[model samples]
Target chain A: MTGKDDVATLEEELPLVELPLDAWHRAKGARMVGFAGYHMPIQYEGIMAEHAWTREHAGLFDVSHMGQLGFSGEGVDEALEVLLPSDIKGLKPFRQRYSMLLDEEGGILDDLMVSRLGDGAFDGAEIYMVVNGATKYDDIGWMIEHLPDEVVMNHMDEQALLALQGPEAGDAMAALVPGTAELLFMQSGLFTWRGVPLWISRSGYTGEDGFEISVPADSVQLLADALCALPQVKPVGLGARDSLRLEAGLPLYGHDLDSRVSTIGADLGFAIQKRRREEGGFIGHARVLKELADGPGTKRVGLTIEGRLPAREGAQIYSGANLVGEVTSGGFAPTVGAPIAMGWVSLPHAALGTALEIEVRGKRIGATVAPMPFVPHRYRRAKS
Target chain B: MSRYFTDEHEWIDVAGEIATVGITDYAQEQLGDIVFVELPAEGAVFEKGDDAAVVESVKAASDVYAPISGEVVEANGALEDEPALVNSDPEEDGWFFKLRVADASELDGLMDEAAYKKFVASL
Candidate 1:
């Protein structure tokens, strides 16, 4: 249209906040998109090529938008245990576990990673937690209202998080920081690089073996430059990140799990250990126990579509004549070489090997409920 | 024979009463790494501006609209197993379908190569 029309469109748009590496991504030819109140890279070269590169080599990701929280002071473990379903009190030093913040009704508020830090990390902060970026502010407010005045919560807004993931991630890290590759899966330790302290964990969302490194916001650009200079490391974007996690059978918050969905229905009961289940002191323990005794009416399951068209979010799922479920996420998987999806379906229709159909653009495509992890994981775990 | 393009980015190469249709190279560049291409069945009839096919990438699925009123004569079969062909050679071998002309006058509203290039630059 006219120049006036362009100005009008710009006036209606919200101002997106830039992350620490916003300029770095733009300089490297990344396609930027508005996500979680920030300008983030959606892709660098292309999604398929980047996805393949990550699985074969190492993919570096800028995840500073995620919330990094540190907790300490009196009874921090017990305080967190009251809000989360995981066994926080028993978590050993230098160990991390996947946990979720649930409402009193047992609905998930946000899924997070909780790690017990020894004197080796973050100025002796007893607990470290990482939450989804979109829901971090809400999570913080909820915790402030629930937690006792004695325990202190520090939002590490000055720290930037990065993930170096793939089969060769260890080699890349070992080259940069000596002895860092000795950590096993779910292990974390404080390390130094060029005099800058780093807290690194041998865990990532992708099913591939990898590491997540948290560094100071000021040093992030330097670290990103150094890491990418390595032949094994390439910068990846959000597009491949989503596809890789989906193939790993990991659920993303806001899409797959929300305030209306229970912990048990998402098949995340593993996060709720036996001691936490029996003790039942958490906010959502009642619903968790009830769902455990009875059954969650709907359960999330993986689906393999038998056609070309992808079943996107909000697509209806059908079994015979009845509408049985809805797809929360679906796309063409580069690793699987087929269309794969995750959906919430009625318990009766959620069993593996169940025949189903997905309605895409008014056409029904054949789909079958299949076991998750469409691709196998390659995490480097310690031998027993 | 000359090529005509529509605002929606579909290109039509008209020769006599038979025309080959596909997306413009610019269109394929915008939709990166095509994972699938859903074409209309042969003998399918449609008026201009109707949805004729769907091309999907890793993150999104976009619809390809018919440039002019026509009847489908043949559909592209090479796209099913090798959708990346659309990304590689969208203007030539990656043609979507063939349509028998239903109304030749509809081509009057289409853009020629020079006009289409200028329009893309404006965007």
Candidate 2:
């Protein structure tokens, strides 16, 4: 089976979301590759150039293929609580929470964003969520089986998502929407630009201050073109997005957190809310809570290689002579100007400042376990 | 003077006893943004078409082969820090090593620039 198909089989089956600029990507000489079921641009110019461009300026990305769903009706929070370990009922409006879709065995199926949408003109008491593109259909399938009939889940397939990221992203976005800079990190609100309604979220996978604008699919091309026309924004592809996330020390769903890995072992214990830890009602809550109270046997950690050579995913990680762990994600970090990686290692060796080594093509290259966010995050937050 | 190429895309230029070895420009482009080069230790002997060095790119790693049987006389230490030189000047500054040609007749069996170009196109 093809790599994409292998992932597709593991996910809950759902329809694929096509972005507005799908044609534009093909016309730009982008190499369309299957990712998360959608034909996405892997590269346009080149991986290196695209990676550097995103780090220096702004990259306009079409992430509309990701699943965007909304839930409403009575006891929506309580119903969601049965599936996720996060305290969704306590989430305030306009605020977004990062949580995982876990299996009964305490393994992560997917990581998703859940936001409480306040009462709107059309709907009252709703919850909006965006899930990973590859696992969205499976995530929806899992939710359907668990959600009570009263809670209606509406798939926002009519919408398109765009991410504009980099240091100059805010300035460029502000010029278009005028007040987008006021949205703090992880906060979303409805706004209109030139009469096009948009749900703008101040967040991104890259460790840059950026916004994810969800707009009607029909108007996606116009919005993307408008953003690209700005001096700071350039069309970026999947190649740079992968490299940028690697540099940011963020996890890729399949490679980093999979059905085989528990949330605590993946260094995502912080995502489990304190109330959930105590109430212990969600799926896999017993194992997760126990691991939280004690600790996981292995943990994910950041790694820095000694030289220019990069350690790719699946490379063996070692502590001196012993095989301790394996590299989950790794690459040449564009922002750090060197090679960096994230891998899971034995709990004792996963701590920051711990030294380790990776065997690359038979040679044991020296590495050190370091703190995550290898580059400090520059996300835009509200001033105190 | 004679020119030879191995299946791995490495080319050798031989004159009497001394031989110059480097990867073809096509090979450099395929590898893309070479980050590391592991050259053979000087004085190491190899038969024709034997793996001699390694060139690593951001996407993958490739092995360089000996186009003609020889003993490594010198290596490119500069590539340890600036492997991009291979992409920039594959024929000149990016030459991997120099060797003492062990079997002069091996050079006769390899391809010239025109033949090598045609061979690459076939791929």
Candidate 3:
């Protein structure tokens, strides 16, 4: 069995990177906990309060520890296509596409954002990706080995990432950088705000229209402080980030998606482009395509509890008296003002509106499989 | 009027046969935000250190132990809807229950207010 000694030895050998706001987080009386290989704030004011605040108004998050890498050079799209199942050739510049890094058996290693960068045109030198923090090192190492010699991967360790999210995030961000409101969802660009260079993308994980700003490490504190000064913005911690994402119906890395689970089973088959499905070149394409065609035996679904009582992760899900599945992520959704959860169940019980039961503290609580994005997504779409 | 604390951080005010029960301020702080409280049914019999109640926080769930053996005569049912009261007024309005003491001598085994403070500080 892999024990603490093994983990400690591995950690000792591996390099650790600290985010720019490490000191700031410590100063704020944050309960720092290790997550995804970095020490991060689990809560400051408190989890529930922060979670509720993010749902109602803008919440500033220091997500600098997430892996940010850029790929450049000739045939970068083709090089990327070799690893990811997404159709990179058809991707337009400035537009970000949500894709996955899959393993040989078609299980997702991590879900990531891939943006083609270079002034509205797909230049050969277009930059390609951002992977999850926990799997970044392994991902980089894997890519370096598999990627063609001509393509160069640059890990953006010098940059710090911050997410400003919620209903009022756009207005708060636009006030800092002029004309920022004009940028549509999934579109990113280089802009200068308060003398700090920022690569801002109007995308977030909280099912809200917001910006994920990448700035130099030195200027990150200044930018975060400036944004925090806004009326709608408040510094949020990782605790809120987890609850918000759970409410948003987004899957977490280790809990929701892991080496044991497939993308089709996770309800993320939409990430696989149609052409890629036909051509079948990426890693684990055969197994993934088969799962896609045959339909998965089990699937992820949302559950809404009957009362204010929250069912937590590892809680057994039941269909009548029989055990059907297990709750992977569950919590009190601050926005919906109710308890919500997500879990994996048999394909027959995975449909929306299917009634289920969650065993909370040994008592079966009434639950129903509900459609996700429990709150409607407020992404800014391009004008027709 | 003398206050005593159990090793589990539960505080009690013993006055003859009746004893007031509540968790310590340090316990509430460590638990973060309290969202739900499951009170023991009124008149339930419990032994000293028995799991008598439950407090659910955003991050975790903890069992509130009975400080001394007794019959639970009254439970704070108001905590059902507003568990935050524990954080706001844990000592007064946030008290969990009142127990009819089965053994008055049990109070001698618990630490007094000053001793409890020193005990907490030692941790």
lDDT of 1 at A124: 80
Candidate 2 chain A least-lDDT 10 residues: A1-10
Which is superior by TM-score, 2 or 3? Answer: 3
Best by TM-score: 1
Sorted into a CAPRI-style docking class, model 1 comes out as acceptable
Q: Model 1, clash count?
A: 0
Q: Write the per-residue lDDT of candidate 3 for residues A1-384, one digit (tens) a residue.
A: 011111122233345556789998888778776677777777889887888788788999999888888888777888899889888988887778899888898888889998877652222338747788888988999889889999888888888899999888988999999768888998887788877778888898988889998888999888888888899998888878887888789998867788777889999888888999899889879878788789887888889999767787788999887889998887777678777888999888988899989998778899999999788888889878
Give fnat, all candidates. 0.34, 0.14, 0.16
List the candidate 2 regions with Cα displacement exceeding 4 Å: A1-20, A118-125, B1-21, B24-27, B44-51, B64-71, B98-123
| DockQ of candidate 3 compared with the true complex | 0.28
**Which is superior by lDDT, 1 or 3?**
1
Q: Write the per-residue lDDT of candidate 1 for residues A236-310, one digit (tens) a residue.
A: 998899999999999999889998999899999999999999998999999899999999999999999997777
Q: Indicate whether candidate 2 or candidate 3 has the larger DockQ.
A: 3
Q: How many residue pairs clash in all the candidates, one count each? A: 0, 3, 0
Runs off by more than 4 Å, candidate 3: A1-18, A119-125, B42-50, B102-106, B118-123
